[model samples]
Target chain A: MPQELFNKPVTELSGMLARGEVSAVELMRSVAERTRKVEPKVHAFNSLDEEDALAQAAASDARRAAAKASGAEVHALEGIPIGIKDVISVAGQPLTASSRMLATFVSPYDATVTTKLKAAGAICWGRLNLDEFAMGSSTENSAFGVTSNPYDLERVPGGSSGGSAASVAAGEAIASLGSDTGGSIRQPAALCNIVGLKPSYGRVSRYGLIAFASSLDQIGPFARSVDDAATVLGAISGHDRRDSTSLRMEVPDYRRGMDELRKSGRKWRLGIPKEYFGEGLDPEVGAAVQAAIAEYTKLGCEVREVSLPHTKYAVGAYYIIATAECSSNLARFDGVRYGHRSKDATDALDLYFKSRAEGFGPEVKRRIILGTYVLSSGYYDAYYLRAQKVRTLIRRDFLEAYKQVDAIVTPTSPTPAFRKGEKAANPLAMYLNDIYTIGVNLAGLPGISIPCGFTGGGLPIGLQIIGQPFKETELLAVARSYEERNDWRNRFPTL
Target chain B: MPKPEDFNLDHVANLARINLTAEEKTRFSSQLGDVLTYIAQLNEVNVDGVEPTAHAFPVVNVWADDVAEAGLPVEDALRNAPEKRDNMFVVPKVVE
Candidate 1:
């Protein structure tokens, strides 16, 4: 595969297709070859349907040719190859969510995002691995195996969108759609050296996404560059009748804001939330983020330190809220209705018991239990209720901080990806990796993570840009400017 | 922080309807204990008068209108089910 294709933004590729400079078949072939080559080392995908992907690409070319001949307005994403996280349902394809329970279960319908991608003429490659039910922060929780960060094979690719992030970074796919609940998308993007966006809760439809935390989960994009990320973002966003929580607000031309920001004489004012720069961040990542902020200073952007007083309690509030929702969403997986059923059981109750026993993994069971425990009648007020109250404060913190600053900058993750299995022993330590990101999700804000620099051992570091709700355009403006100045988007792993 | 022994995995597993073997059960207890111990850190933070939030943004009327939309066709929806006796999801007989 040529590095040119890897470096080209999706918009550029779309133009190439429109001008007959490249055919969809050729583009898909290049990426298909790359996916086969890198996936073994990176462990990025749970399923790879090469025949279907090629067919889809060939179909895209045929459609585009037909449209041009017929003088029809062409959809912008025609012929792009986008990887999808396994959890999202694509009609007639197996959607495992990287879990064994549904290893052989094929989806009966396409998820809202999947249908949108197909309609836009973007070919869907097989599903990518993730933490089971999107629970863990590291892809290590995947039942199959850990997804390695292509940047450094020894370290993790962050999860639960870890595979989605790594695949795009390694040039396996042009972009990917990933779910964000407590920073799953951004944290992984930060660790893998790519652009990952977490749309505000309800900004994008989640009808087809396998539920982890319904209230917090939103499907967003991970691409090699900010512009590519924005293209995919625009394609998948908009209200869907299938998802009740889907927003009906006008979908902005996300790319337009970047132009406005670039041409405007307005000064850049960025807030560095005090709590983000506090105690636990890795020194190297901190330095890299601060340097990135300083570069914005040269761009006529002013930086100021601000405080979000409720930051300390975000993790607690997140786990409580996320787990509580997880418990409810997962209730349907009772081994009877949909997927798994134990081979034999003494009774119906035993069937539900044994089938679920054999189906879900240990970590997933842990969450279900924890969620159930927290939401149980006895503990609801103390744990679940209090977490909800604090969740309000966490949201308020962002509103209050945004009142004083146009956008806020933080380390996408507290530290770079640790070695696989390093934090699994202590789930709390694993959860801590989300400290920098959980609040953004908690507050239903949009955030993006872009590679800023590297660690001492050559791992990637990311700087996060957070914007107020429905402000994805502004978020990308701050991100694209820094990305253009630095050109770190093309950085990739040797693997 | 909570003690390691505070959580009993067996009881939790029973509630979750998972039948873990003795060995698996033993392993889960310690792991669940660690997870709880970590979550216990949140107890120290004070969120007085704070309201618990369910959605990140306020999205009233997330529910679709009561429109009679077309649902999955019976044939297509039943294509994947290994065994179906009628136009519905099927399972082994629950009654003896």
Candidate 2:
């Protein structure tokens, strides 16, 4: 296996493919070899069909060869190997979402993101692990198993996009797609030491994405570099008639934004949200994030202290809203349609009970029950309605802060990756893991987490830079400035 | 915050359509109680006049033309059906 090829970013790999120095088949083979070697230790993939991946790679190579002969250019992501979160449908692949409910389910149509990746000539690798229906913070909720951090085998790769970040960090995949409802993408990227972006809600279509909380879910990219993240976002984002909520905005050339920002040498005013730095924040993680903020100052960026007054209500409001939406969305998975069916069921209602009871894992069931409680009679006004009102306040807080800052900075997670099962016993403790990151989702802003530095234990710390809605270009540029100045992104796990 | 005794686990589970065993029901009762206690902090906030935000962005009536487009073929749509009959999902008999 070629370590050099495995480590090369998509930009470099694309250049090699265009220059005819490397064939798409060769890149796929290298990745396949790497996946075979590291996957056992990391448990990053739920399932992989190597033969299919190789076949796609071969087609990409032939297409590139034909384009070169005709003096035409290939697609932007031609020959890049991309792994997709299992929740996102890729036609003909098992879309389990790391749950027994959909364990045998196969997608009939590609997700908008998957279709875009294939159109751009990227090889789609499916069945990456996630929290069952993207419910839990840690991948332990995955029915398949936990995806361990590549940096440390005992620690979790932050999830529900754990495998998405871990595979990219461990060199199993060049780039991967993960959906962020709360802090799924960014937290995992922070833990795995990679770049993860959650575009503004509706920036990307969710037609084929297994809906968790449709209002908050945004499929984004995880990569080794900010540039790669931007490239993948550009490819996947755009309006789709199939998804009525999808934004009807033009997708910007995010890759160009990086170079343009660099050439302009402009300064961005960044705000440090006061609430993020206090209470339950690990000292070492705080130090690393603060150091990254200081580096921004050195890079000619100004930092100001800003307060999101309603920050405390974010976690409660998020759970209320997310789970309520999830209860409705996941109801479609009853045994009759496409997911798991109960063999012992005697009637239609018995089938739903037995199937959902046996199919969904504990965390998912907990959420469904809680969501049901919140939306149930008599409780809806006190719980769900109040949470919605609080949600508005949280969103208003962000709107107020954006007036003073171009991007807001914080730690993507309260602490670095914790040992697997550490927070399993107490659901609230696990929910608190996303305290800093959840506020961004509730506000529906675009947020990116870039590897800032490492804790004393060698775990990665992620510095979150949040931007106003649809300002991912500025957000990425701010992240790029930090990523370029620091050598943190260059480090890879010993695995 | 409501005490653990305040919740009826069986009712909630029934509403969620999950049939939990005796042990799971007891465990979930406590766990759900703890989570609810934590979430009860939302009551501390003053949300008197704030409008609820259902969607992060405002969206309404995004209608496509009243014309049908090609949809998933019957075979493809039913490909993942766990049980089927006559090109339709086979569910347990509903009417007595």
Candidate 3:
């Protein structure tokens, strides 16, 4: 099958729309057709309404037409169709987070990210699948259906943003939005052979995103090219009063930053974190990432080895803090207000217990129990409080390294996408898949995963770039420098 | 690895408001035991005198204007309620 108009990058599509070459309705119809063709094999979307998408596309067309007649400016994403992870609310759409607890829950209002995307003229089309309540590393934990890797149907797409990555890899949408708590966006992007960025904590608003781990969760973009990701990030990022955690910083035009870095001819100091390359990393992935580093050197970027000494403790601290926050965040699904209710309940307490037990999935239940146990009277100081302190150490490690190097590079994941059910039986093994990416979240810094190369069996390898706090422009610039040197972004799965 | 026998699954389940079956309890007990064993490495870090970070950024007391805003309508608010009556979510009686 030929690549449809929907598979073009948002930049190209924007130019085409401006040049009167393609109507928004035509572009939307092509995407709808592509979704119908690829959905069965990849299972990327949770819910999609073609009628609603076309109506939105038509509205965008009318706005553009009026702008043209009045000689006014149109938004950057005037008619681009994007897939949204179900965790982010789009008003009037199902916000399930792939859990039965919100299986029938329709969002009453748009999330901050969704509102900004709509305001910038982006069409938030379908509800993408995710790990149930964004707890698991794989989408197999979703109650809806597991999203298959577009590269290989038998293997898992690295999650909990599996559907977000799979949709773009399968060319079902032009671009997509995903939330990363612990490598949710980057890991899946690497597995699917695409670009994914996790902006600095508080860089984007989180008002309408169904909270998993509040402090670490950030909504970002996934695209086939670095420019599209930058464009989308610029559109959705800014200060919002609704979320107190949102940063009070000015949003820069990130696409311009990418172009500026491409021409600056400046040598950036890149750090290779030695801890990330040792022991469990697959040999093929290490070699590919090392080669990517060499390409950076050839592009006049200085490379040196730097140590994030507390890297090992990152997973430990992340699990403790994330689960603790998740336990408190998800407590609202008690059947008193909305979501699934139990029929066997005799009293309020029974209703709470039965409704939660029936509504939550196994992984969610396990996290809730673990979180509750850690925060229990005797364990709080030893577990929850101790983890928080170690989290501070992890953040300090990154800060120390940033003084010596402009950015740190590591393999996004230890290995390529694993076969379905390979690590599902052991939760610890699944958690270790995020060993390389979780430290970025712990430090609350920006990180981007761009495809570097492929394995012998053709699975994609991702090289991650970690930046200083609120330095997404520099992060995306470094990513684009490496991106422009290779054709890796052009490769897509023939699903 | 921490001994799975040391943690009582039933007690924790009670605190979490989940009524797990015997099979689920056994499964979770062993799996969570593995995870807890892995996370036990945090004890090795020397975090003395470090202030615990609850939020990523430091923004204290972010106050908004007190003007009343148009909020979710009664119909939209109760749209997803499992049980509702008279435009309000209905729950079991808490008091006798």
Instruction: Return whichever of 1 and 2 wins on TM-score.
Output: 2
Candidate 1 residues A134-193, lDDT tens each? 888889888788888998888899999998998888888888988989998999999998
DockQ of 1: 0.53
> Which residue pairs clash within candidate 2?
none
| Model 3 Cα lDDT, one tens digit per residue, B1-96 | 233356778988898899999899889888998888888777778878999977767789899999999988888888888988887778888999
Weakest ten-residue segment in model 3 chain A by summed lDDT: A1-10
Task: Tell me the spans in candidate 2 whose CA falls farther than 4 Å from its real position.
Answer: A1-3, B1-5
Model 2, range A1-495, lDDT digits (tens) per residue? 344788888888988888889998999999889899989999999999999999999999889888878988687689898999999999999999999999899999999899999999999975799889988888999999899999999999989999999999999899999999999999999999999999998899998999999889999999989989999999999999989999899999987977897789889999998989899999999999999889988887889999998887899899889989898888887898789999999999999999999999988999998888888887888888898899899999999999988999999999999999899888889999999889888888999999999988899999999999998899999898888887887788987
Lowest summed lDDT over 10 consecutive residues: which window, candidate 2 chain A?
A: A1-10
DockQ of each: 0.53, 0.79, 0.70
Instruction: Give lDDT: candidate 3, residue A71.
Output: 100
Determine which window of 10 residues in candidate 3 chain B has minimal summed lDDT: B1-10
Instruction: Estimate, for each residue in A1-495, the C-alpha lDDT of model 3 and write its tens digit.
Output: 455796789989999999989989999999999899989999999999899999999999999999999999987789999999999999999999999888989999999999999998888999999999888777999999999999999999999999999999988899999999999999999999999999999999999999998989999999989899999999999899999999899999898876787688767999998899899999999999999999999987889999989999999888888888888888898998888899999999999999999999998998888888888777888888888888888888889999989899999999999999998888889999999989888788999999999998989999999999988888998998899899887877877
- For every model in order, the fraction of real contacts preserved is 0.56, 0.84, 0.79
Q: What's model 1's overall lDDT?
A: 0.83
Quality of candidate 3's docking, in CAPRI categories? medium
In model 3, what is the error at residue A143, expressed in angstroms? 0.4
Give the per-residue lDDT of model 2 (tens digit) for B1-96.
344466788888898899999888888888888888888888899888889888899789999999978988999999999988899988999999
Question: What are the runs in model 3 whose C-alpha is more than 4 Å off?
Answer: B1-5
